[model samples]
Target: MINDEDERFNSELDEWRKLPVFKQALVILHLVEHIIEGIHLDDPHPSTHYKLRLYERYTRQMMENALLIPSEIATADSTDLYDHKMENATIIRKAAKEIIADSKGLQASGYKEAEYLELLYDAVEEFRPLFAEWVQSFSTKNFIIDRWGLFNPPGVSYDDPVDTMSFDSKSFLRDLEDDWDDGDDDDLI
Candidate 1:
């Protein structure tokens, strides 16, 4: 019997066309990079499969933030300078989808770092009259960690998530288990 998660993921992947083009692009591109980085053989390993499984767990998280462009811009209470990041994120996701669909798309175009750098060029080129000022605003600000692992100015304090590699086995052994609880309590007569 198929469970909820499998049913949901299968349905989503099957109905990928319904999602915004950019969003599909983002996720697909992310997966593509994952494959290239992990399964390309030159830098490949068995852990690639494991990492993909790990990535699947957080797949929905990216989709949740795709609309921040319109959301931030439309409902922004602050200046008009930096609202583009939201839209840029959306485009980045879209482009990623495109890249995933066809690696030859941008990689063939000589993008050094195909994931973020590919889109970064367009963003930089289209700057000014388009969004140069906003980009400048971001530059001037301090490097606060963004949800995407990039930096930002002091805005919200986000909890940096620790990866699996950070787990301390020794500490886990020392503190996480209390197996001595078979309390052979002496019920003295």
Candidate 2:
């Protein structure tokens, strides 16, 4: 059976696919594919092969990061979701940087063509502004008071008092057990 989460995931996938930023990411992925396709995976030298492998791994990670963006946006609106999306963006940025670095390494090692590296770099450069715009579109409102201090909006602090009481799972479970042990449970059925 298709459950709620599956439905939500499909919906979010559709939404993100239509986004210009996501489309730009896909173009980058296509460039990565071409770059990978041009690599000679059967290089005789082990170190050269390893460097090529690293380049492929970083490019694959970039693709995965792009795929994760939709799910990050699909998370329930809260400070937690904002934090998660920010974290994803950070990862994407790091991966893109790594890809460029690794491309240079591959070129220096004579394992990759300058043309492919330049193409990949150009694609990532094009993707950057779209990525920035997408990040700017995230809503900072609809967030709960972030108790950890890290994800809270500016002007909010972890030490700030809130009206809602914290939930006590142990106390709730104890009361539930007590109710189950009592004879009144018969009426609940």
Candidate 3:
């Protein structure tokens, strides 16, 4: 049996996939808004805090394809999708580079913590459109969305211990708050 947290995450992902494009976009935006607001209220150094750190971070960009239906037109195929995604990937790459470069500059100028926060927020915002486009171009090929490669990047963990169908009030906010780890281990990375 799946753990409670895992079930909740998977269940939520399934439901998220089931939502219509317009609705999905709204949901993503809403989640982003809350997360952004929470940045000021929550632990800024937490790994989960940066989940929306980029368009490529969690393959959230790939979710863009959730509403996409493959074209019935004869000319549409992988080549078309690839060409389109490549262009988008280019844009995503550019924005990512800009965010990184600017971040380094901000640090070099000795505005590390304070300015970095604002930069992080803007960088995340830059990713929104490219991510949405990715979702927009998404089409299932052999039953898989095009975002297959981009979903899981380095450092963003999706694994958890909750269930989707049944609410685990037991560990609900606990996991989100990550209250258990005491930082005694130095094996980070």
Instruction: Write the residue-wise lDDT of candidate 1 on 27-124 in tens digits.
Output: 43444444344322222677656554444433333323333332332232122223234435445445334333343333433324555544433432
Candidate 2 vs 3: which has more lDDT: 2
What TM-scores do the predictions have?
0.23, 0.62, 0.24
lDDT of 3 by residue, 22-111 (tens): 343344344433433343323465553443353233223222221122121111222334334444444444544444454444344333
Task: Give the C-alpha miss distance for residue 105 in model 1, angstroms.
Answer: 20
Q: What is the lDDT of residue 58 in candidate 1?
A: 33
Task: Evaluate residue 100 in candidate 2 and report its C-alpha lDDT on the 0 to 100 scale.
Answer: 69
Order by TM-score, highest first = 2, 3, 1
Model 2 compared with the native: what TM-score? 0.62
In angstroms, the error of model 3 at 111 is: 2.0
lDDT of 2 by residue, 22-110 (tens): 67767766766676677666658778666767766665664565454434433322223454556566666666666667667656656
Q: Candidate 2 — which residues are off by over 4 angstroms?
A: 1-13, 41-80, 144-150, 162-189
In terms of lDDT, model 1 sits at: 0.38
Give the Cα lDDT of each candidate.
0.38, 0.62, 0.39
Winner by lDDT between candidate 2 and candidate 1: 2
State the displacement of the C-alpha of residue 32, model 1, in Å, after optimal TM-score superposition.
12
On TM-score, the stronger of 2 and 3 is 2
Error of 3 at 11 (Å): 30
Q: Which predicted model would earn the best lDDT?
A: 2
